[model samples]
Target chain A: MIALYRVLVLVGLIGLWWLISLQVGGVIIPSPPATLGAAQMLLAEGRLLPALGDSLITFLGGYGLAIIVAIPFGLLMGAFAPVGKTLEVYVFALAATPRVAFVPLIIVFLGLGVEAKIFIVFLGAIMPILINTYAGVLATDRDLLEMAQSVRAGRVETFRRIVLPGAVPFIIAGLRLGATIGLINTVVAELYTAVRGLGGLLALYGNTFRMAEYFVIVLMLACIGVLVAEGLRLAEKRLVRWKSGS
Target chain B: MTEPAAHVVLSGVSKHFGHRDGTPMAALTGVDLTIATGEFVAILGPSGCGKTTLLRLLDGLLQPDTGSICVGGAPPRPGPETGLVFQSFRLIPWANVRDNIDFALTSSGLSLSERAEKVDEAIALVGLQRFASAYPGELSGGMKQRVALARALASEPQLLLMDEPFASLDAQSRELMQTELMALWARRRPTVVFVTHSVEEAILLADRVVLMAPRPGRVIESLPVDLPRPRWGYDVHGHPSFIALRRHLSERLRELVLTDPGSDFFQRGAPRS
Candidate 1:
């Protein structure tokens, strides 16, 4: 029944798009069928998939590195007040700053390459991961820590069993949020100057006013975002099944 | 049943907090207590009487500002020799019942096989055998507290410190746990220090109940419950001596709360400072 509603919604959206395209004419807006045909052409010509591959490489590198660095760093900051106090200002500043502003700076520093694209994505992704992990670590239940202390649990054991596991939910939440923003940054980074990826393709097709192709690429980006977010959600539910009393 | 041995001793034990500025807040002061081996003692008092603090001191989770506490002929320190059960039943949400109990035995240098056996035994002892793999979140309030008790017992500690372990349970579960605790104590006989606010609970469990006063908390009275062993919960509550003791203690507790200046919570019925 839910699937049927979703299919109906899709049909409704396509009908609306078709109506708009007819009224506006195909110059600025293309019909849903035109976009689908364009998507198939792009797929057959090996244009879309390779761009997707390129985008994914940068996204994974930046997002993965962010996760690796941010989680441990956040843990330290959250666990120790001295570290948190020292680095808190910088983390907040980066997190608050509009990351699109860094595109030009990244290009200047790293040049127009995969490195620049990855750096921008990292900047976009790192803060959410860091903040969430920090919050998670700090949110370790006081009673749990007291229990650990009373039991004479060693420092390593306490961290491994208590601290890390306690923070898993928060870390996963951060990763999901980071992956989404990281993907956005990847496209933005590519759009600026880098010669490959979906963002670069979007820019080329956009400049030439290939409305059907542009719409197709945008649809692909949206699909990728939803897929990645859904994947993380499923993994989180599996890993922390006890959280919901399952 | 056996000759009493000094398993725990606290002399002039004074603890203060918030001393960073100048005037420190004394949580406990001049507390002197001695617990014999295999004794079950409960420290009973109102809020701010430092009962929990006293229990923590016994567990070596906190140190006194002045004076000394010794457990098993040594200065108090956290180790496998002592186990603690918190009021909230702080089992790790991520760990199952068996694992939560096994946690207490982690540093005992026991082999995997031995540790597993101890874990299973503790679970069975708590009658949580069927829910060995259930997480704390999955268990009811009564069951969670049982897991906490099991975890504390798993290490086979010489001393067990509990801070109002059953205070959160419903009245029925509380009474059931009281009987179960009596049964468990009869079996293992660990030197136990339980802190609680309930008069009936203190009378029900402890061999001796130590009453504490607030405002620089100190031991005010110590009474021995010469109640017979195998004291059934429902019947014992109606016993003549039980009635006399309960009446006296309950009246004394009410008078203390009403008259004592430190008992700010009951100041409405008392002369104001």
Candidate 2:
């Protein structure tokens, strides 16, 4: 039922956009059908697939790395009070500052390569993952910890059974946010240097006045965002099955 | 009564929590007590009375500031031989009833089959077999506490420490749990230490109610309850000495508040136990 309503809303939005495009009668903003046509052409020419592949590779590298590093580090800071106190200020400082401010320095140091792009994505995505994970670990139910302690559950058992599962909802929320931010950073990285990926195509088409193709790339990016978020939501539902009714 | 073996001994145990302004607040002071095997003792006191602190001392969750505690001839520390049930049913929200019970068995060094057997047995013991796969969030308050009870009992500890286990339940459920607890205790009879503020509850469920006075908590009185065995669903209110003992303890607890300057004004017109 919800899916049907969602599809209806999307169709209504496209219909409105199509009507506006027809009324404007300009190449600047293409109609939905024209954008779809450009998407097909890009796919037929094999350009869309490769750019998508590149974007996915960069996105996965940065996002996966951020998750791997930030979660455990955050857990460490949260589980141990001394570590949390020492690192919390710096983490907040980094989270507070604009991530884009570091892009120039990252590109300058790492050069206009995949490494720089990955670094930019990492900088964009890492803070949400780190902060949310920290909050999740910090917010672990004290009563549950007391229960575990009273039962003499060792460190490993406590972490595995209590902390990890307790932090799942927060971690999944972080991953969803990270996915979106990572995509945005991927575009910023590519647009900055005009090097590769769908962001490069976006810039290439926009520069040449191929408005429909540019819109298609933007549409694909939106689709990718939706897919990543939907994926995380599905995984969360599976992992946190006990949190919901059967 | 036969002289049972002394399973827990506390000698001059004291615990102090640091206040923000630097003055230390004594939670428990020079608390010396002995609990014998198969004995159910209730530490009854008001809010500030450190009944919880005493229980935590025995559970080894907190170190005594100035003394020693021994359970089963060893210094107290959380181990497989002891189990603790918190007032708040601390069942893991992410785990089902069976898994919550099995969690207590994690460090027990038992094989998977043995753990499963124990977990199932405990689930049955608590009458939670129907909700064996239910999560804490899905269960009622009473069922959740039952799961907590099952979790603590799954390890088959020689000593069981319960910190106001039924305080959160509704009156009806609390009464039911009291009866169930009595039945369960009648079966295995572990060296149990139950901490609560309810005078009647203490008498209903314990062999002896150790009353602690607040304001630097210390045991001021210990009264033996001559209630019979298998007291579940028994007319505790109709017992020969029930009203007399209840009224006496009630007055004594009230007197403690009345004498204390801090509790004087507030305790006036306050509800009685």
Candidate 3:
């Protein structure tokens, strides 16, 4: 019964969409089928896949760089009061600003190339991950830390045994959120550049007034973001399974 | 990394905690104690009685304001001579029980193979051999405490400090753990300072139970329990001698607690048996 209800709900949405498009004319409303067909035609032209592939490379590289830098800094900030105080307010302020606002500025500085796009993606993705990871490390149990000290555990071993394990779930949460944002930022980065990612395609489709094809690319990018986020969540679940067992 | 020598001395040790807003809050007064190698001493007191502070002083986690603390022929060295078991178990959430035990042994001068062997031995000693791979979160309350014990014991510390390790467990589990601790202590006699409010646990386990009084914690009574091992844990329960010792210790603890029940920390909690 629940499955039937789910089917009916989904059908109702699609039926409404189709009704609106057919009644108002596909030229104006652009039915889902027309968008899908346009997407297929764009793929047949053999451009979408490579463009997406290039976009992902930039997305991942930028995201990876941000994470690598953010992780150690975040950990340092959390563990040390002076460092956190010095960096936290400024970091949050920077993160709070929308990355889209920086595109024109970034383009002027780095030019309309992969570097600029990657920089934009990095700007978008780093702060939340950095902030949340800091919070995670900061919230680690002081008792457990004292336990490490009571044993006279060397500083390195203390980090390995206690600090890293304690901060993992939080780090994973930050990373999952960052991955989706990184993808979105990648598209936003490409929206102005000559780079052939989905964002660039959206721009090209827009110039030609082909909004249906643009809509298809947007859906595809949204799917990628969801898949990436879901993957991280699964990994977090597996990692924390041991914690729950005890 | 000093040699794992064996000495723990608290000479005229005292500690004070300020208020939440940083006014003076004395936690310990001038107190002197010496725990020799292989001595099992229990610091029995009601809550906020500076028993934990004394233990921490011995462990070098806190400094005594008025006195000096020395461990292993010198002042507390940054190495593995003092292994502590907290009430909360405080196990690393990611590591399994085996890793938790092995953590204390990491800085010890044991080879990898030796560490592995000792980890297994400790698990067996605590009767947690079957759950070696299990994480702390998976274990029952009793089992978590046992794992805590195993972790402390695996390092083969000359001094072991426990802050009411069994206070959280049920009657059956606590008794079972008491028996397990005795058997293990008999075999690997580390000098132990176990802090607890339970007069029964102190009497049942300590070579000497140091009864502490409440506000600005001070040692009031030091009663000896020289019950020889292989002491049967079940038979020891309500034994005439154990009961007599429990009564003596409880009377002292009650007096200390009632002196200033105004502290509000020890108001609503476990009664000393």
Candidate 4:
């Protein structure tokens, strides 16, 4: 029943798109089926898959590095106030600044290669992951900490049982945000100027005035991005089902 | 059946909180308590009554301003010797029941096998063996509290401090847990200190209920409960002595409540006998 409803919605959306294209006087707005056909052509030629893969690898690297650095640092900041205060403003100031502005400098330092693209992805993803992890750590239940203390839990034991456990939900929420932004950064950096990935393809197709191909690439990217994000969400639910009782 | 010995002694224990200006706000002053090993004692008070503070004092979460607390023959320190089961269950969100219980045994000088064995025993002891792998989010209020109890007990702590462990459960579940607790007590009785607002619960589960009226969080009364064990849910309410005891404590609590805020929650002509 749900599938049928979705299919009906998709049909209606397609019909509306077809009607709009006919009414409009330009080649800019391709019909839904035409856009879908273009999308298929990209898939068949194997260009889209490989480009997506390239984008995905760089995206994961950036997001992965963010998680590695941001989370432990966030934990330290949250668990220890003085340390948090010391490092807090540095991250906050960095996060507040328009990271996009750094792209030019980053290109200068790292060149317009995968390194630059990955760096942008890292910068974009790191803040959400950092902020979320810190929030999660701070949000840990004080009562549980008391309980842990009462049980004669040592410092490390208490952190393991209570502090880290409490931060998991927020950490996952942060990861979701990081992945979303990281994907966008991958495409944005590539579209701006880069050697490989979907963004580079987008720029190449977009500049050549292959409007149909551009539309198709955009659609394919949207699907993959949505699927990856949704997949993470599903994983979060399965892995963090333990959060429900809390 | 016998005289309960004092297991943990708090001598002149006073706790003060520092304000923003570093001025002290007294939470407890000159608190001298002697908790007997294997005895179930309840601390009864209102929301601000510092009953929970006293429990924390025993747990070593907070230090007293001008006194000392000794637990299980040592000065109060952070470790599994003083187990606390929180009113809200406070189960770790990332841990299943088994892992939560296992956490207590992690640093107990026990081998991995020993830790696993202890966890199993604790789970079985709580009658939550079936829910061992279940996450905190999946458990009911009662079940979550049971996990807390199991976790606390797993380390074989000589002292257990409970802050309204049954407070969040429904009345029926609370009553059931009360009996379950009594049964657990009968088997492996630890020197237990429970804090609660429920008048009847204090009488039902405790050997002595230390009542507090709050402002300064001092003990107003220490009433001994002389009820025998093997108590069930129905039996707790049905006994004549239980009724009389409940009536007295409830009346005392009612008096305390009605005196302040000028609003009465009790009936004008409620029977005392």
Candidate 5:
């Protein structure tokens, strides 16, 4: 029933898009068929795959590095009161600052290349993952910790068995948030620095008033967003099976 | 039964906590108690009476501000020889029943096979063998408590400390758990110190009941339950001895409540300034 509703919604959205295209002309808003034709042309020309590959490289590089660095850093902040208290203010300050503000500095240091793009994506994605992981560790049940202490579990053992597992849900939530932001940053990095990926294609088509190809790029991004979100959701379900009970 | 050797001793033990303003609040003051090996003793008191505090002290989770404690001739410290069952169950929500029980045995210096065996035995002991693979979230309140019990038992602790283990359960489950606890006690014969606010529960499960009073919590009376073992096999509550003891204890408890400064009875009856 839900799937049927989703299909209906998609069709309704397409119909609306077509009606708007008819009224405004295809220059501003391309019809659905025109966008499809543009997608096919891009694929036939072999430009779409290479551009997608470049974007994937930038996205994965930045997001993967963020996960590796942020989780452990967050764990340390949470596990030790001194570390958490000392760094939390600075982290919050950095997170509050706009990612676009760092673009000039990042480009100056790294130049107009993939490295600059990766840095921008990392800056955009890191805070949510770090903050959520830290919160997760802090939110571990007091009773569970007491239970661990009662059993004479050592500090490392308790962390491994109880604290880390307890923090899984929070970490996954962070990952999901980070992923969406990271993808956005990927496009931003491409457009702002080296114009070599899907963001570059979007700039080219949009500037030339090729609305159909511009729509294709936008739809490709939407598809990628859907796929990443769905993948994370499945991973979360597997990791937190106990949360759903029987 | 022959007199068993003293397995636990607390002499002049006192514990204090600080209020938000930093004033020291007396949780347990000048408490002295002893328990014979393989004895089932219940500490009964109203809320704020520090029964739970005393149990924590015994479990080595907290240290007394004054005096000393001994368990099995050594200073009390949490180890394989000491098992604690919390009222909240405290079973790991991410772990299955078998793994939760296995967690308790991890620090026991047991090999993998031995720990697995102990876990299996504890699961069977609680009659939760069928649900060994189930997570705590999948279990009902009663089943969760059973998992907690099994976790405590898996370590084969010589001293078992339970803090209101079944107080959260429905009445029927509480009664059923009480019987099962007795059966487990008979089989393992651990020196058990159970804490609860319920008078009937104390009388039902314990061989001795230590009554405590609040406002600087301390033991006021220790009554021996002379009721025979396997007490559940008969109508223990309706027995003449049970009736007499219950009446005396209930009256004493009522008097404590009525006189307690923190109780609503005193709060409502007090003259306004």
Candidate 6:
């Protein structure tokens, strides 16, 4: 039933877009069919798939790197009081600052290439993952820790069995947030650095007044966002099933 | 009757915590006690009497600021030899009943099959065989505590330290758990030190009740309960001895509570009359 409503909503949105396009004309606004035709043209010309692949590479590289570095860093910060106290202010400050502001500086260091793009994505994604993981570790139940200690579980064992499992939901939440932000950063980086991914196509089409192709790029980005978000939701559900068992 | 050998001994034990303002606050002061092997001892006191602290000290979770504690003729340390149950059932919420019990045996150096056997035995002992795969969140408060108990018992600890294990349960569940605990104790006969604030609970289960006073928590008296074994089978509560001991302990407890300056009633300067 919900699926049927979702399809109806999609059709309604397309109809509204078609009506608006007729009013504005094709140069300013593309009809749904025009956007679909442009999507096919891009696919046949083999432009869209390659651009998408480039974006995927940049997104995965930076997002994956953030996961690797941020989780342990966060864990260390949370597990040790002095490290957490010293770095907490800086982490918060950096997180509060606009990530886009770092783009110029990142390009200066790494040049306008894949490295700069990856770094930009990494910078955008790392904060949420690190902060959320730190909070998760900090939020681990005291009673559970004492229980582990009472059983003479060594530090490693306690961390593995108790702290890590307790923090999983937060970590996944962080990952989900990181993923969305990472995708946004991927586009921002593509635009600012060497023109390469879907963002490049968007810039190219918009500048050339190719409204249908521009709409195709925009739709593709939205589709990617939806797919990624839905995937993470499913993963979160599977990982934290114990939480909802009752 | 010849007394069994002392399995646990604490001498001149003192533990203090730094208050938020950095002032030293004594949790347990100048505590001295001994428990015989295979004995069931209850440390009964009001809140803030450091009964939980004493249990932690015995479990080697916290070190005493001064003096010494010995369990099984060695300096106290938590291992497979010691099992502890908290007031809150501290079962890992993510781990099911069986896995939670299995965690206790992680450091036991037992192989997988051996650990599984021990876990199964504990589940059966606690009558939780059907809920072995159930998570803590799925279980009721009473069932959760049973899982906690089972986790502690899975290791077959020589010293079982329980800190108000059933205090969170409903009244009916509490009664049922008390009976089940008695049966388990009778069968395993581990050296047990159970902590609680309830005088009646102390009298019903413990072979000896060590009364503690707050405001620098220390032992005030040690009273022996001479009630017969299989206590649940008989109307132990209505027994003449049970009545006398309960009355005496309750009076002492009331006196202690009223006199303690930190107690709410005393702090409020409530009229005694």
For every candidate, what share of the true interface contacts is present?
0.69, 0.75, 0.73, 0.75, 0.75, 0.73
> Taking the tens digit of each residue's C-alpha lDDT, what string does model 2 give over B1-273?
878889999999889999899999999898889888899999998778898888888888899989899998988888678889888888888889999999999989999999999999999998888899888888888888899888888888889899999999999999989888888887878888999889889988899999999879999888889987777556878897778889999988888877666574454756658
| Consecutive 10-residue window with the lowest summed lDDT within model 2 chain A | A186-195
| Candidate 2, CAPRI quality class derived from DockQ | medium
DockQ, all candidates in order: 0.70, 0.66, 0.61, 0.56, 0.76, 0.74
Query: Please, what are the lDDT tens digits per residue for candidate 6 over residues A1-246?
Result: 999999999999999999999998978998888899999999999999999999988998999999999999999998888999999999999999999998888888999989999999999899999999999999999988888877878888888889998898899999989999999999999999999999999899989999999999999999988998898889888888998987
Q: What's the lDDT for all of these models?
A: 0.89, 0.88, 0.82, 0.81, 0.92, 0.92
**Model 3 chain B: lowest-lDDT 10 consecutive positions:** B261-270
Fraction of native contacts, model 5? 0.75
Residue B125 alpha-carbon offset, candidate 4, angstroms = 1.9
- Per-candidate chain B TM: 0.94, 0.95, 0.88, 0.89, 0.96, 0.97
lDDT of 6 by residue, B90-147 (tens): 8898899999999999889999999999999999999999999999989999999999
Error of 6 at A239 (Å): 1.4
**Candidate 6 deviant stretches above 4 angstroms:** A1-5, A8-12, A15-27, A80-90, B267-273
Residue B181 error, candidate 6, Å? 0.6
Alpha-carbon RMSD, each predicted model? 2.6, 2.5, 4.3, 3.7, 2.3, 2.5
For model 4, which pairs clash? A151-B79, A151-B80, A152-B79, A152-B80, A244-B137, A245-B137, B14-B65
| Rank order (by DockQ, best first) | 5, 6, 1, 2, 3, 4
What's model 5's TM-score? 0.97
TM-score of 3: 0.89
Q: What level of docking quality does candidate 5 show?
A: medium
Per-residue lDDT for A1-246 in model 5, tens only? 999999999999999999999999988999999999999999999999999999999999999999999999999999998999999999999999999999999999999999998899999999999999999999999999999999998889899989999999999999999999999999999999989899999999989999999999999999999998999999999999998986
Report the poorest 10 consecutive residues by lDDT, candidate 4 chain B.
B260-269
Question: lDDT tens string, model 5, B1-273?
Answer: 777899999999999999889999999999999999999999998888999999889989899999999999988998778999999899999999998998888789989998899998999999998999998888999999999998998888899999999999999899899999999999999999999989899998999999999888999999999998898779999988789988988878877887899876653444537
State model 2's lDDT.
0.88
